[model samples]
Target: MTKNIKANGLNHLAISTNNMKEQIEFYTDVLGFRLVALYWMHGVEGCWHGFLEMNDSSQVAFVFNPANKDAKVEYGVTNPGHTGGPSAPGTMQHLAFNVDTLDDLLNMRDRIRSRGYNVMGPMDHGMCHSIYFQGPEDTCLEVATFGNADYPIGPKDWIDPEVQELAGISDEELAKFTNPIEFEGQGGTIPNPGYNPDSYNPDRPVQLLQGMFAMPDEQFAMIPMEKRPPSMMSDEDRAAKHAN
Candidate 1:
C-alpha cells in the first residue's frame, strides 16, 4: 500500500541580507508587507533574523550577519540584477509573488512605482500575467495573477515534447516525472541506507558526513532544532521591542 503526502504551500523564503533594517524598510514600506518577526537567530551567533508577513502562515525572512555585510556581490553570481538574468547555479535568480487578480497585480505595480521604483510590465504569459520590478540588493521581483482562475493549468498545456527531448528525458522518465511514485508507510522499519558517495553527494568532508550519518536520528534532530542560546529573546519580547 502507498501513502499520499505533499507540500501544501510555501511556508517562507529566507533570503540572506547584509542590512536587516534596510531590507525591512524595503519589504514593509515599498512592498506593503507587514513586519512580523525581528530577533537574533536561535542557534547562530551574531546573526539577526527578520520576517515579513506575506500571509497568515507564509513569510519572507531575512538573515543578517557581520560576515554577510562584508561579502561581495557579483552581479551574475550573487544576484540576477533583473528578471530573466543569470545567477549562480544554486542561487535564486528571481522571486515572484502571487496576486489574486490582474487588477491587484497592476495595483502592486502602481504602488512600487509610487515608491520611486520603475516597474516593467503586466505582460501576458498565456497562463498568467506578471509585472516585474527590482528590489533592494539587486533582487529581481515579480507579482503575478493567473490569466483565468476558472481554467485549470496542467502539464499537458505547458509541457512541450520537443523541450522534453532536448532535456534528455525519455517518454518513461517524463511520465514518472509528471506522476511521481507513491510511498508506502514503513512504520520506522526502514534503516538508514548508510553513506554511499554515488547515491548522496554532500559538500561536507567525508569524516563529518560519516559521523553525522552514524548519529541517532533523535540526537541529530536536537542539534539544530533544540538549541536555545543564552542571548536568545522570546518572539513576544522581540516583537514588542520593535513594535511597528
Candidate 2:
C-alpha cells in the first residue's frame, strides 16, 4: 500500500450516450434514479451532460455527443457487458452499486426485474450478497450488500497463493502487502514537485482541462468553447444536422 494519498469513495461515474433524451428516460423512468442536473457540457459546444443521482455523492453521469451517431457498440471490447472480460487496456469492466442490507439487495433485484430487465442473484459470496444485470450501453451493473457488517474482507483472505508465488512475492513482501505504513492526512496545501504539464491521457476528462491549463488566460478564454468541430461530435449527432 502507498502512503501518498487516500481516496474515500466513488463520487460519480460518467458514461457516454448517443441519445440524451432516451438515456435520461432509462435512468429515471426505469432505474428510479432522480434527475439531478442537465446542462451544456462546459468547454464543449453542442455536447450535453446530465446526472442521475442515487445519492448526493453517488451519481451516474451521461455525456451526449449529439453530432455523431455512427459509432458501433463494441461488445466485449468497448463494454464488458454480461461477461465482464478484459477489453482494451483501460476499458471499464463493470460497475457494482452498493446497498446496505440484504433486503435492499433483494429489492433492487426485484426493481430491475420489474423494469423488464433480467437480473441474477443475491448470490452469496460470504462477505457480500450481489445481484448482476446490464444497464444502457451494455454496461454491466451489479448491486451488492456487505453481509458481514462486523468484519470487512481483506486481501489476506482473497489473494491467490499461486499468483503470489508467480509474482515472486517473498514473505517480507507479502508481510508489507498485508500490513503497510499508515499516515494521518493533514489539512492545508500539499506540495507536488514532480507534476508535469505534458501529462495527459486520452481516456480521462481532466485531459481537456490540462490543454486549457497550459494556455495563457486570454488565449484559453478565446478557445472555441462554442465551436465543436465535426470530428468532436458523435456520428448520430452529425447525421441529425444534415437531416433534410
The most accurate candidate by lDDT is 1
Off by over 4 Å in 1: 1-3, 147-152, 185-191, 199-202, 224-244
TM-score of each: 0.84, 0.70
Poorly placed runs, candidate 2 (over 4 Å): 1-5, 148-151, 165-244
For model 1, residues 131-216, the per-residue Cα lDDT tens digits are: 88888888899888885544446787878899998999999998999998876656765666777788756798988888877777
C-alpha local distance difference test of each model: 0.82, 0.74
lDDT tens per residue, model 2, 1-244 = 5455566677788888887788788778757889877866766667778988988778988888765476677866787557557666676788788888989888878888988988989788877888888777777788888864444677857677899999999878998878876765655334333325577434555766556455555664585543564457786865755452
**Candidate 1 accuracy as lDDT:** 0.82
Best of the candidates, TM-score: 1
